[model samples]
Target chain A: MVNTSGNVLVVDDDKLICNLLQDVLMRNNVSTMTALNGEEALSIINSSHSIDMVLTDVNMPGMTGLTLMQRIKGISPDLPVVVMTGFGTEQIAVKALLAGAYNFCRKPFDINEITTIVKKGLDLRRNSMREKEVIPFLKVQLHFEIPSDIGFVRSIVNHIQRECGRLGFPEDVFLMRVKLALDEALANAIKHGNKNDFSKAVGIKAEISTKKITIEITDQGSGFDISRVPDPLDPKNLLVEGGRGLLLMGLYMDSLEFNENGTKVKMTKNAQS
Target chain B: MEITTRENVEISIVALNGELDNESAELLRENVEQLINEGKVNIILNFENLSYSNSAGLRELIALYKLANSKGGDLKLCCLQAQIEDLFSFTNLKKIFSIYQDENEAIASF
Candidate 1:
């Protein structure tokens, strides 16, 4: 077997799941250690060789997955933790995401999908470690040029969420809000700015600093006149399905700005108060 | 997604026991459309087990509401978890749909 040199801790109550994941991860070139529950996982994490990441289950008998995540955060704050949950357990997934999970997968998950997520977590950790050596403060710039695809947009958001968690940002204040604003902005860029044209591209740029986080999204169409846009709050427009996205962006971010052409939008949110 | 539909005192209570996401929103749309086409439009979507939803799911809900209203029927929701309620509130969707605390209250409201 190839040695990927990435050590992963796999925590699950089910022996079958542990075995399945261990087999899958190992064949993919990564080594793994298995734990039955949160306590067991923490014990391994606290007193073992370096673990590059964690793969955990959300629902356990004694120490829950979320509690395990929190405890893992306490031990190794920057290590990415990927939570695994059963299908239809969306609530648990949401809680896990909010609790700073690097990512999550549904039960009976595909080997390829799990391996890809693990690899991404490993890459993020690698880049973070490198950045720590070079950058003095939290000055991170992530730029992507993607087609107007929802799946790509979601992946970008997930990565940024993990970055925010790693930076120790207040999860309650920023994680969900940032996700919402990004969704709205990206949707608008795709639907309105590019008119859903597959050939057109959307540019996403994110910057994080000690006191401010700024995100800029630019689309490839002629801009609209802000003054001509309907006021969604007006009684006549209350029931309209559209136009709420911009409002949501305005609400969630500390400041919102549009370029002179209005094709590019910028949103800035301040650090925790 | 697990969708359980049953009739309770002339009101159709549809229990959604999964995440409402882009993958499942189309299914939800189809299910509700089937109910509306059958004239079982006065509905209550029971969200006791629902945990998360994305923008695509929200779009489906808005379309479902519009369809129900145009058909001379109404759609109410019940047992929303805190995050789901906050989502509706955030979008001001609470103004369009009547939300109840439980199935009985939602049925009574209609």
Candidate 2:
């Protein structure tokens, strides 16, 4: 149940369609601002103080929805944009998803379905934002330069486990998800980032709370673009022998953040999980 | 990670404990290759004792699976912990490999 004062920008060329959705959204306790085209949508977005989300039609006359989506992402990378298209135009929906739209809904949408999607999208955005805040019970900082030695990962894991134990986290969790995610992150820093150069060191900053934990790993090497990291799940990459560590970290951890240069990475884990 | 092997008739049951990671993956690779070179090819990896595992270890499993098959042998795996099962569920390895609930079932398959 969305009981808000949250604003959604509805973009579609037809006035009647816009009113219908605005009515549907308002009846569900969501407020809306409508635009007849993508250009108008952009203008409204620029003027508004805050828009929680955008629900747009893919086939708008001027400045198509996909292009508008790209422009919105440029300004607000994490703003949820629901790409709506007619029933038969699923190809555009797929394209929109690939181009980083939050989600897609088909035209002739039901009020129930649209509201549910909107609520879920807002929840996801809020949860990710919450993960960024480190309300720490305790904080630990460490630095290490892993040499070209066997079982170096084990040594690092042991050190972290010691810190986790002192912080009152459970051993089972330390051995399970924590160990796996830390191993992958450290391996990336050592092998890929620093090329296992004994002279290079990785910096680590960790915040631990009774409920959650966040770890940041920074390396000395030149970083690559985070966007170009391929999806290991893609058909071509799935069967490859290695390169699945980062993907595994994503699965085992709550959220991941990387600096623009990708040399630094942050991972958060819910200790209670 | 520690790799120790025991023979149950024609099948070699390899027990893996501790973490299976980049460094340990090499040890498992060498251990399996040695068994294959000795013409003892049918193997069942008992993961009941795995404390940790990752993609590097996964890569070794894939390579050994392929190599064993090329020589008319098969690698059967069993006793997956909840975490390992979760991992397999994502990587398509769950569908690709022959997984059993227990060492008895895995060894019985041979």
Candidate 3:
């Protein structure tokens, strides 16, 4: 017996075909698991972590190959699947391929073609797993400079909020929380930092990645001590409206910081997913 | 923000139809002040049409709330958008304001 090269799950309603494919794959030094129907195939897939690829017959008694492939995708999105169809079922094989099967082959079986397709699928699976380990998720960065006037702040905040959506913030509630944080930071920059001076400008930078988002806002005015910002949640300060903005900023963001002079504020929020 | 006031006897229902940001907060404050000056102190701010608000707008609301209380009446809120309601929660003002699900409920509170 040859050492196993890869593990492939073969599914078909016909017992003869299942054994034949298993025999062929076994001869190719590939380990094979045979399931007589889609349900059995799913059972194997759920229980076995070693399934690298699926080789399924298009027309099955229970769930068709297309349905099984979709189910497999739901279970393991990147796991490669190959579909097999008998003669005159070319259309079903094509449909399976379109539905995200790695490849399809018509039967009465070409041994070489079957082995080649199976090998390729296993290679792709191995490569994909390796890629995932090394590849970093995409990051989005944005920067804007505008007059310290409050007029431009809203549009900039809106633009950043939209980018948050693109960065996969799944909830509107989370997006709003981000918006509120930005609003408070910008208002602090314009109103207190620049003292509402139209001649001054605010510098904004935002970085959005898969794991977290960071926003930095800088104004041309003197900065203040973050420790001095009153706790709005305090019972005595509950009715005091002035300090609530900073409190909101602190609460909404995972991290909030200010420069030594108090001109710049940075806020970050981790992705909730 | 466009604030449209409807007098329900001694109570005033003020509907805000735009964002209640910094500039618009002043507009809302002025409009609500007009209602207060006219002895319509029990105000129900209908935020059904209001889409967005920040700290500036919230400060204005706090001012309005205090003014109504000082005048021996109450300021209530109703139909706040999800984000605005969240703002109230984050600022710890949700507990201070009389929030209602709808205009009728706010009116009934008074």
Q: What is the TM-score of each candidate against the true structure?
A: 0.63, 0.60, 0.62
Candidate 2 lDDT over A188-235, as tens digits, reads: 887888888878877766666556667888888888776788777777
Best candidate, TM-score: 1
Tens digits of per-residue lDDT for model 1, B7-28 = 7556788899977765577889
Per-residue C-alpha lDDT of model 3 across residues A65-107, encoded as one tens digit per residue? 9999999999987889999888998888778878899999888
Candidate 1 collision pairs = none
lDDT value, candidate 1, whole model:
0.83
Clashes of each: 0, 0, 4
Off by over 4 Å in 3: A1-136, A167-174
- Candidate 2 stretches with Cα past 4 Å from truth are A1-137, A145-150
For candidate 2, list the clashing residue pairs, or say none.
Answer: none
Rate residue B22 of model 1 by lDDT: 54
Worst 10 residues of 1 chain B by lDDT: B51-60
Per-residue lDDT of B2-24 in model 3, one digit per residue for the tens? Answer: 87988978798999998888789
In terms of lDDT, the poorest run of 10 residues in model 2 chain A is A129-138
What lDDT score goes with residue A105 in model 1?
94
TM-score, predicted candidate 1 vs. hidden true structure: 0.63
